[model samples]
Target: MSHAPTHVTCSAVSFDWPDGTPVFDGFHWAVGPGRTGLIGLNGCGKSTLLKLVAGELSPGEGQISVAGTLGYLPQNVTLDTGARVDEVLGIRTTRAALHAIEAGEATEANFAAVGDDWDVEERALATLDQLGLARIGLDRTVGELSGGECVLLRLAALLLARPDVLLLDEPTNNLDLRARHRLYAAVESWNGVMVLVSHDRELLERVDQIADLRDGEVRWYGGNFTDYEAMLAAEQEAAERMVRVAEGDVERQKRELAEAHLKLARRKRYGQKMFENKREPKIVMGARKRAAQESAGKHRIMHTEKLAEARERLDQAVEAVRDDAEIRIELPATQVHPGRRVLTLTDLHLAHGARVEGEWEVRGPERIALVGGNGSGKTTLLRTIAGLLPPASGEAVTHVPTRFLPQRLDVLDDGRTVAENVARFAPHASNNVIRARLAHFLFRGARADRAAGTLSGGERFRAALAALLLAEPAPQLLMLDEPTNNLDLASARQLTGALESYEGALLVASHDVPFLESIGITRWLLLDGTLRPTTAQEVRESRWDG
Candidate 1:
């Protein structure tokens, strides 16, 4: 289908952090009137590019041009809790003007304030309703809303403004399934030029194209996330094939060079023998020797050049192959017998009015996914189960050792190196053993020595996971709260892989359905007002509400 004309353009854009860390150098891209998913590794500058386009950050050396007005929903939505919804939605003045006019105050100022938006309140409410915020009225304060609701409120403001260019950064990060569906619908219905930076696979599936930002450049893929994966897989396959071909060429060139050396040596030896035997006149023999030497030198140089060219080709081919390393570590001590009781919750009443009416028990290596709407106390439940928080009533008992990886990822000490953090967890293990085990988590040598605070989002996640899994006593019951919250696609996959090697019981509170399924969650628990058993299909279909 014919698409809208390009509305956003970046020309030779270059950006650098204040500390001299360079992000983009001469980056250029043009986005048309269609949903574009900007994705990459955590530190590949996807969010930075969005900030540049939205005028939140200035480029060091280039121009960012947009054809029309822009609206941006940043990844972190921080609103004044005291502010009313209408004020946040940019309609408080208009609403006041309408109310004043209705009260017979027909002033020019009120008329001007109302301007062309006579239906401003209706539109604002409609936008909020579309974003699953119908329960939240325009008169409500931001403080009354949950974190996910605040994100939707910000989105509602953007939608109400109806800017020509829209940018959303990790829009679904705090949203639940129902709210995410509403956001997905809104994205599907969006017609203006849009760019989204998110790790939410479902949200990305609604985009028209994928903009993969990597290694200081943007590569466009034509389609949604699944299509991008297909194309990327094909490209990687071809790249691998080219690498093999280039490697073979290099080997062949080496062999040819070796043969040339042997031939030249043999010829030189034969020439020397002839010279020694005086087979020909001294002058003729000298001329022959010189010619032979020159020929051999030319032959050697020709082979050397070919070898260098082959090596260059191999290097280029290798560059084309992506290096998305997976986390692979063994935790034999984390294993539990099938009949082992890992955890039990009896008549639990958690903070925020969430409870388990009856006895609940986790046995063996059961992978349970705790899911619910935002503000439904999933995190609270996990914290209580992890012994970090006490339940308001009843008890949560862990029969085995437990480790909790919170959403904040505060398990590691920022001042310490990755190896040091692991050592803190595995205190009984030797320094060499700690470093050796950390290598399986993709933190090798110097990486293991780097401070946790200096690591990127993905690297920090791997380090935290390594520390959690490598503890001294070995946690037989592992609890994670929104583990994939800010992780990139690759990092999420690495987490899944790492969990596959985990032999303990898993309790994960997350909104990431794809990730939960990939980790082989054996059971699904909906933590609404109470914890109840559910299925993956029921969760995905939103049929759990009764």
Candidate 2:
């Protein structure tokens, strides 16, 4: 597909938060046609840049120019539940005008409203169906849809507009597998200029190119996420090699400087002996001494300059190496014995009225993945297991200390700082201890002092995870519901790394297949009416029919 060239251009753009935290300063970017996946670490201003290009935000400096009509789907999709579908699709007036004309009211105003879109309803429905929302009638209310459906519906609206440029931020955050597939198809079919800001590897693979947003600037890559990673790995390898060479150069320069100093000292000692022995006239000896002293000073200056240059090169070489390290969390006390039963669900009935026909036992440090579609009662089951909700029929019990991280991350207290929140969970732990552990979760120094309410999406997730894993009694059974929902790629990998150090049993309910696989899940349970044992391959390859 051929898209207009230079569809979006941002020049010397700068933006800052109300608290004076800088995001971008003199940033410049130009995106042409085809799908461009915008990827970066969390809180790097990828979403903010998209918003600026969509005209939802004004830059504090510079200018952004879009060549044609622009459409944007923000990270969070929320619509009035009471609103009609047509209103959400942004075609209520046109639809009503067409209906009025059909009803024999041939007013010029109605004709103007209807204008070239006599088939707007058909197009809207077609777009909905294309996004796997065929059952969602045009007259239906927004309240009748599921969370994943809402995202697709919003995308359907944008598609109906047929804008020249489309900007999507984290479009697959809450979508399930099937919905993600539908979204992927939509992206593949997109013919106009599309810039997608996402951490989803699969969705990014469908893009024609990648715009790596880092340090408030965009770095263009010729291919998709996989290609970008490969290129980055090669670049890192070359940088590391350069760093090694620079270190050697710095050491050589230092040694040469030391040798020159030693040689100059020996020459001074020899000159001193000749002066004392009266080998020549005192004036001649003094003149020779002066010349030697001046030569020594010049030599010292030359060696010092060379050493400084070598050290500067070493500094630049070190800076070229990336510093993307995963969090290193150590939770020895959370380990569970292989023979010990961590959790038992005996003919359990969920809080949402879903029942498990047979008993399920989690032993040792087994990692369990709870797979289900939207409205499959996964959260309710987790809540029941955590004892936050009463079971409808049978028993849900945990033999060891347990912790639950819900989809909303309600475990955190928004009013308190991250340290205070963790302290709330582990009151017996001292402030120093809490800060120490939070540091392991990548929340060092003043970062831990930030209020939970002020944290970005990824920061909040990390804080919540820290609180849960660092709680007193060392939760032996940890249950997480959609933990990766709003996490960027780096944050998700960080979560997986944190879990790697957790020796306890894990029951994670999520639609993120790659994440579940990364945590070394020992078992998979498909949660429909009953918890059926399944395989990771089956989960990844097969479609969810329920």
Candidate 3:
């Protein structure tokens, strides 16, 4: 039985950029009331499509119907840096309410005009509580909140509108482990349609369907990331086989053309001999000459045409469909022999403002994780280990050379070429040596010639790593701070795989659960002004528990 139609339905969507470069060409998608991830590489038409659905941009052609209410959380915009968290949450509705209250005109009709429902303090508190923000003071403002907190508040405020559909752009960009989990939980429990666009694999995997936007087409797969990968692999294999067959056909056609030309040459020479010998009457000889000439001309034309066709086929066979994945990166060898016990922090003390005593410590050769939300000092502890920040008072001994990848991506030289950046970080190496190293990081050919700032987020990572690989004596201790930020799924997996092969010790401060699991992280040291060791399972189950 056919039921009522959905709120979102687009027919024959097509759009082009300012210069007439096609962005999305004749794409169609019907979004029902459920979570569907709008997956694509960065700069794919996901954002453009989102604008079309939100009615921000008119489609170049076709009809787009979006019924019911819509809630949207954009990727980035100007925010009140000096305002507190509470004010940002309540600013729009709160100001209207305040004006109503101050005027002593708190009429029911007035409240209805401001928002869909009456503007009540109790109702605001209820909504806040539902979104995990009950106790927060409205007067506190947005300035006090960090990136993750601000994102959470923005999401909470949108959810309060109780929209029929929610559109989130990069929802997990600035979130940490706890807050990411919080968002995942909220989305999983949601009843309305959710269209989420994010680069996070773990986040994308949770959605119902994934769309791969490439070359102005929406190649959507009807499942999660795994299913997409499986289908892609099968298709790539099929394409590979087709290319091989095409190559063989091209070669066979070339051989046949060559044989035909050889036969034509023989026929022409035989005709010439008959003409010279004068073996028949002139008229009969003329007819024979005409026939030979015609036959020779046709063979030459056919052979040349066949050769041209074979060349075209060869070109097609070489450039046929193929998956272009940029993931092959090599990790540098450890030069500094990890001295027995490369690093040791026993009965350590760390503090946010006040010290949490004698509860934290780690040893060498251990692949440990330091996980917590923003302002929780995961970065602080990583810095402490890297010797960037010294301890207040603790027995911290580090015998190995350590390299730290900061969250800010400062290890790379933004002004220089990718190869130059690598050389700068690794000053001891020659130019050729440095370029080779950069090439191994997948910034090969013209890509390595590009400036560091000009590269994509994933390419920037390779440049940073190229420099880090030059750590003197080869650091046996590698500490990465949020290494998974902005990384595509394939790149993240490749980086994780490379790290897994390293014999050196690793301490990573990351919210990417899938990456941590893939690289074999054992116990985690939960960061909350202090460090506490716990199992991976425990970290996943609890929320905001110190």
Candidate 4:
């Protein structure tokens, strides 16, 4: 597929963190005027690359060039709560100037400030409306908006800038289904050079191409995430086949080398016998012995060189094969009987004015998905159920042993190792058991000894998940709040595999429809003003009414 002309270029760029953690070294990439989905395993420098291109970060070596204006929406957006929407949109001064001129104060400075943006307010409102933020007036304070709304509001500001290049990192992270759709539409309509770093599958489906960042280099794939996956799968298949062929070559070389050694031993023994028999003059025997030794040494050297070359080829072939280790855990102890009652709620009134009236019960090993728009109290409800938060006017009780994995993944102690953290949760399990269990979570041997604070995003998630699942008494009811929020595709898939092995009750609060579906959610509850039973289709189809 053809792409737009090149708009951004990075030539032999190199960067390293202050702590000496090497990120990218001599990385080169050229992005054109079309949507490019930047993807990789967590901590592979996808976000760092975007930051470099956006000029938030400077490369240590080489150069980067952008053809036009640039705008960047970071993964974590921090806005001054006290600031007005217009101020955050960067039009506060312009709007003030326009208002002054409209009030009959047509000063030279006012005209200069207003410049050509005579309809600044209209344009700002239009941009906000386009991002499903029409309800958020320009005069409103940032504190008044929900997390997801604030994300969209930031995007709106970028849209209003009319930048030539746009960078968005995890743009759909906290967004609800409706907000995601709005963001998707905005992304789909973008005509500039757009680079989006996200784990959201649906958002990635709209991109023109995929830029896969791995091992400090970028590989371009024409088309979206699905296309990238297809291409990667094919590549991996070929690499695996080459590995097998290389392995066979190495074995054959080893056999040939062994056979050469055997032949040399036999020749040496025959020469020794001839010398012992004294069948020729001493000089002749000595000369024949030297010749045989010389020939045997040459033969051994040739076979050894061939074996070394074959081994090197095998190593290269193995390196080409990706080793994305998966979590393979068994949670038979977490299983609840088919007829057991796991949790119950009565007149559940959350802290944020959201409620679940009357009686609510979760029985057996039911997997329920709690989904809603931002500020709909999904987290609040989950916290209340986990006993971390007190309900405003009701009670939520879990009959079975339970554990909650919050979105922040704060379950782990930063100072503790993975094994120690898991031990904290599973006090009854021995160190060996804990270490063995952690292996299933992909934290093996030395990896389990790494401090929680030192882990990458995906590693931290896996560690936290292992701690929660391996807790003492084997939590029969697991509550998770936006568990997949910042997870990479591979990490997300690992979580799915781990969850599939869990035979307990699951109440997951998430906006990730694909993840919820993957975990085999048996029930869907939409948390608006009240908790109401819903379906996945409705959740996907529903738009944010706020």
Candidate 5:
């Protein structure tokens, strides 16, 4: 059936963080019924914008309007540990009223509370099942659920609300492969106005359009992320051509200005000779000199203005080109020989009772992809290898120096500056050397001195990465637990690029298929009770517990 047009509009909206950091200034955008992927660099205020639309935060200026009821799923989904699934799904009150009426206690309040939602419990169960949470049931408490399950539960809650305008921010951050697939299905089936901010490439590919938030403004692209990328590539090529042409124009202007000066000097010389030789009357000579001087003055001003204008055009052309920086560093010390055994696990039993069961070995600079559902002991295994967690039964031995980058990126001392953090890790490195290296990671000059706690998500990640890579003795074995969890697309790419230079044995636990593939994962190990060897194709086709 046809329905009223659903849309969301923001007019002249302006917002800033409490610390006076500007986010949006006089920004305006509108989205009609269909899913629009809001893609941008990290710290571009994607989450903040969603919060503003959801009414969790107010704009400093302007207004926001949504055509119908709105539902929002934030990046970090937190639930009370004691709360039940039904309560989180917002059906607890209605469910209780329905049960009261079913029990023959037909009170007016119960009926009113259950108005038009008599089947809420059933609907909630169905939604949960759709999100692969059927086993969770309605009675389970949040404390019993895994991180991935919690993310899915929050999404299920939003779906149950069925609001006309839906806003989701990084909904797939901690989700497993199966949960991500479920979210993708939900997005595909959504018919209302939906806006999501996510770096998950697979999820972004499902959108109807892409709205790129950059420089405090929104730029619209007519199709999905693939289309957006193609279009951006073409635009960048054109921008580069413009820059070249502008550079040529500026050079030509410089030569012309020089020629103008040469002509002015010759004119003065000629005029002086004429006046000295008395070739004309005194008044005529004087008038001639004055005319020549004025002409030179005008000529100088004209050329100067033209040069300034040309330079401005060059600046504009350069600005049109995207300048996203890439991370580049050398780690020659991390190299491992083909026969070297980097890590070994022998009947390792973790704290939560998940066991490695048998002996496993990682040799050379092998890149291993650790894949499984959340709470599958991937983090525990990595931690054990790093010596942060002791194995309950067996042992996790590292033949080389190892470093573990946790999901939260807590490696950095928050109170310390980024430079100080890096120095802490690389105590022997000189300050100049650390700063020079930090520049390659996009923390140039004064930025390296900023406190780690004050850094944005992307910045903090870079800092933590820098510290890890710059550590003393060099990390010959690096373990990253869901490294791409909270990173934006650019930052994720940066991490991938940095890994390209890494010559160490790598073990990364992640649900990002594309990222694993990009980094050339040499082995795929499914971490259930045992570490089962699997292929990328099998991993893609397989489903795991919620």
Candidate 6:
């Protein structure tokens, strides 16, 4: 069977901020069949580019041409709160609206004829059920379901659309271990072109190509995040060597220029005090003047050449990514004196219509990692610790001041401006102090005054963390639930670098194996119905999912 070919062509595409500051400068890339992962560190414009592909936002200049339909899953969905899961799937109401239009419901006669619209609801419900969203509460309010559930609900709708090209932005954020695995499985079987952005290295390894974004440019490779990192390192090494050679040339020129100036000055001083025509001295003076002029001219030419060499060297030095490391916040000091027994859980149980289960006790600077497949209880464990969910039995104990940064940072107020949110949580802080604190997180000036709703994914995340740090005495115990979800590699490294030197104890639940390992986790706890220490064998085999 011969099938037609289609493509998404973006030529010389560019976008700008409201103030006309360029976000993308003549950026261009294309998409085709199989899995294509869009890689970038925070603020590199991945989300904005994705918006262009989704047709939610237009470009400032250049043309973007798509030959077929598009399907997208945004990083976050704005739910009506009162809407049911099936109703949110698009199909439920789509049918009634189409039927009404077909019957000319705009005309008073057909409006009465199209009574009780139940026909499409059944089919929508069936489509959702087929994707394992059977018990997703077709009637439950959107506000009642968990973050993971909302993401899954949105996934169902996108799947039903079946567009020629699919754009998924951080689909694994806020998801537990088991939930992440399920997402990968679904993507692996997808029959259309996919362009995704995720920090989950394990997830990216499954894609066909990895396109990394850094310092406002995109570079693509044939493998996963790890593979891309290796290539990046090699390229940087070569660039550095070139810079070193350029520096040598620059220095040589500077020295020659200085010598020329000195010679020219000496000759001028001698000539200025010339006592020519003093018998034999007149002939000697003439010879000296002639030689000095030649020497001075040669030096002058060398100096000019040196200046040009320096400029070339500076240009070569600009390729280094070292300056892009953002996040300058003075993270709350980690060094704390927590009580001997920080936390102890004596046989806690989470009832899913069964007997007692889930039991464990964690205490003292135990850098523990909770790992499991998607749908496993990683985030649930984090939540239970956060006190959002109650244990069915037993008890959870903690003796230190704790703070939890959820996968979605839902702790922040979406409707509030960055400053307002900071002021609300850190009311004791003076206006000047609060602004300075937010500035360190890169919210800077007018951007900090903008409502949280208007910020990009990276900006929202930075604001959320800034709010947490504003408390007078920072929390001594830190809990992070998939903190790397929507963060690009550069942002993730900036965050991880800060956390490594932090003085507080940390309990992390993440699928970024490389990052987790870098932080030097002291132990691993795999979540089943209960929490238990992982075996050495399991640790050896743990890798970014492929």
Question: What TM-score does each of the candidates earn?
Answer: 0.92, 0.94, 0.75, 0.92, 0.93, 0.76
**Cα lDDT for residue 73, model 5?**
88
The TM-score that candidate 2 achieves is 0.94
Question: Residue-wise lDDT of candidate 6 within 1-546, one digit each (tens)?
Answer: 014465677888888877455788787787777788898757678888888978999998889877667788888766788887657876545565646777666755444443444455665566566555567646667877667767877887777666778888989876655556667887888777788888777788889888777666777798766787788788888778777877777787787778778768876976867744354477787787788788777768767966796867667675563455466666545455544566666666654311124445455666777665445567766777778888677766766777788877887787888999989877888988998988777778987888777676766777777776666567667788877777776677767666765666788887666777877788887765556678434744654111
The models' CA-based lDDT, in order, is 0.90, 0.88, 0.70, 0.89, 0.90, 0.72
Best by TM-score: 2
Query: Could you give the C-alpha RMSD of every candidate to the true structure, in order shown?
Result: 3.0, 2.3, 5.5, 3.1, 2.5, 6.1
- Tell me the spans in candidate 5 whose CA falls farther than 4 Å from its real position: 1-6, 413-416, 427-432, 543-546
Candidate 2 has its poorest 10 consecutive residues by lDDT at 1-10
Q: Please, what are the lDDT tens digits per residue for candidate 3 over residues 402-439? A: 88898667887777888777766667888787767666
User: Candidate 2 on 101-163: residue-level lDDT in tens?
Assistant: 999999999999999999998999899999888887899999988778889999999998889
C-alpha displacement of 321 in model 4, angstroms?
1.2
Q: Which ten residues in a row have the lowest lDDT in candidate 6?
A: 351-360
In model 3, the worst 10-residue window by lDDT is 352-361
Residue-level error in angstroms, candidate 3, position 387: 4.4
lDDT over C-alpha atoms for residue 51 of model 3:
77
The TM-score between candidate 1 and the true structure equals: 0.92
Give the per-residue Cα lDDT of candidate 4 at 507.
94
lDDT of 4 by residue, 335-371 (tens): 9999899999999899889998999999999999998
lDDT of 4 at 492: 95
Error of 6 at 390 (Å): 6.6
